[model samples]
Target: MKLASYADGSRDGHLVVVSRDLTQAHYATGIATRLQQVLDDWGFLAPQLEDLAVQLNHGKLRHAFAFEPEKCVAPLPRAYGWAVVDVEGSVRREAGQFQGPHQPLRAPAACEPALAVITGDLAAASDAAAALDALRLLTLAVDWRLDGDLIATHCAPLAVTPDELGEAWGGGRLQARLVALHNGAKLDPRDVAAVPGDALARLARLRALRAGQLAGVSLGALELPLAPGDSLRLDLKSADGQHSLFGAIDLDLAPPPALP
Candidate 1:
């Protein structure tokens, strides 16, 4: 079931169950008022939320109203931890071939794109599930600063989840894409590189996750620079155009302080 947390004049906001088509919603306050609370007790709350979803779809719930994405924040605004697995070059490495320069590559590789754990509180993560049962799901929109330069900034919305996100990596590669926009102008499209066969299996091998921790797998490898007044928008769509995930974040040298 699709779920979202909306701004309700509170830090955690109000949790709601969104319809499949993204048109309508029903307040899930009866089950949980915050998204993190529901995820913390997913075993017990999922079933209850599922039942409510059925009722809402059948026109049986009261106060069901139109749902807008703009009014919603990241599903989990403040998670315990957010880590990204870089699957972009997994395929090429497995075949004993390097896609970049043939020169002797240095150690501590320049752009190996290893698993990166984001620091700070500016990363916004969103979900894109295939069958809704997948444990490893979600995409990310991160605010970044240029290396060694604190003033230059950029926001990258990368790693959209493909429809195969829930499927096992059975000697097959999943296709994905990332489309980025800067100040309303479209940038070049980045085709997601193939994920190696063993990546997913390794991820599954890890111990079960705790309540508030989140793991993300990014699909595309496009990077662009942004200016102070510029805005960035990213959209990741499934190969069949059925499922899509989106994120938007602004860039600034230093954001203004929050109001008291």
Candidate 2:
């Protein structure tokens, strides 16, 4: 069970509750029986939970709580459908992958580490707004870093309708661009396009390209780990808002730190 507490920085009235399972974020209904079992086992406090409501909004469980904070215990809604659950369930050291209720994580296959931005359709209606919102959500970049570098900075548009986007952007086209900034110079954009039908095949090619480049780096691979403060900047946009995630890995090798 995962747990967190929040207060107005006060020692009293702090709310503490255990998050019983990962599936609760996806299909709280599917885990309904199990959830009851877990809560029951926790003793008297478990039964005290009433006004429990379920969330269908999407994203993490927080959405569930947000929908009706007072009336019930809401299960996390199935929001933008992006999840990066750790294998050990410890929420530490794991790869990132985009998952929708009906879509399998294997659709994109997790190999290189990644950061995924999930914006709903209203987001696409305002590309500039979506881009800025995506940036704000991406402060969690360190959680998605791999190989001492971030494999890809990406996005997933949700909620907003296609017609809404078309009305705003004047076309059915949306895009996210991530530039590699080195020594104050921005490198040309790398390809991370998400297309239909052969998207899987094309993504395979992109991964191959990354591997080949990483192998050939003359400075040797950046085996160093990223410090907590390290991060990469990414830009993203979408037209339909209902689309696959966008991502790109860094192939450039950073110069070694200066010697004393």
- Give the RMSD in angstroms, all C-alphas superposed, for model 2: 16.8
The window of 10 residues in a row where model 2 has the poorest summed lDDT is 211-220
Single out the weakest 10-residue window by summed lDDT for candidate 1: 93-102
Candidate 1 contains a number of clashing pairs equal to 2
Q: What is candidate 2's local distance difference test score?
A: 0.25
All candidates' lDDT scores? 0.45, 0.25
Q: Which ranges of candidate 2 are over 4 A from the true structure?
A: 1-176, 180-185, 196-228, 237-260
Among the numbered candidates, top lDDT falls to 1
Candidate 1 structure quality by residue, lDDT tens digits, 1-260: 66666777776557887765557888898899976676666678867987887787787877999976666655555666544445542221111111111111112111112211111111122122211233422443332223522221111222222332433122334454555566678777655544332333333343333455544344433455443444555554444434454333322222334689
- Across residues 132-159, which tens digit of lDDT does each residue of candidate 2 receive? 3222111111122343443432222122
Each candidate structure's TM-score, on Cα atoms with residue i matched to residue i, is 0.61, 0.24
